[model samples]
Target: MSDVDAVRLDLNNPVFQRDLHGLQKVERHAALDTLAKLRQPNWQQVYRDKGLHWEKIVSIKPPPGIAALCSVRITQTRRAVAYRDGAFIRLLAIPSDHDATYGKK
Candidate 1:
């Protein structure tokens, strides 16, 4: 992601804060861990030539309206992508189910 393309999280946005806070909760720690793996060099490849790539979407569960597109951070940048109305909200940080699906069997 380019510096200009970098998401500027509105700290004042309640929905953004709420979702970010939810990600910090103890129950979601595993998700946070999965996000960490995504931040690696190999994982950061998707951001090179393409703005969005299929491999970056690690896993997904659906309500059809909401979705979690788990992707890695290339720099020290952190951001999230939530699906809404056929588009991404581009929130704070990507959610994950790492402990549940990344390596556990």
Candidate 2:
């Protein structure tokens, strides 16, 4: 697979672990499906209607110390947030509520 096909997690990040554990069955399935598509080389061409409204988190400022953050829709109510780490998308959180995904300063 090409570099664009990779998505990594900071398995060491407690927040990431916590958010993942908090997902409901359906939400978790959807998130995993999204991740699978993200692993494909042509993921950008994948349908957003199929559930990947990938977009940058622009409303709220990131918390202190974070440089930038972006998010992808996992389901209608859930979002998977991350930041670019070289060729991979390092997942940061999977917040169910839209507002929580943007985070606070």
Model 2 misplaced regions, further than 4 Å: 1-12, 42-50, 62-67
Instruction: Tell me which residue pairs clash in candidate 2.
Output: none
Error of 1 at 39 (Å): 22
In terms of lDDT, model 1 sits at 0.39
Any idea what lDDT model 2 has? Answer: 0.67
TM-scores for every candidate against the unseen true structure: 0.28, 0.69
lDDT of 2 at 39: 57
Candidate 1 Cα outliers beyond 4 Å, as residue runs: 1-15, 18-56, 66-79, 84-105
Model 1 lDDT-worst window of ten: 82-91
- Worst 10-residue stretch by lDDT in candidate 2? 40-49
Q: Candidate 1's residue-wise lDDT over 1-105, tens digit each?
A: 444433232234466456556664553564455344334344234345243332334454534544544443312223444332222233333434434322234
User: What are the lDDT scores of the predictions, listed in order?
Assistant: 0.39, 0.67
The best candidate by TM-score is: 2
Q: What is the clash count of model 2? A: 0
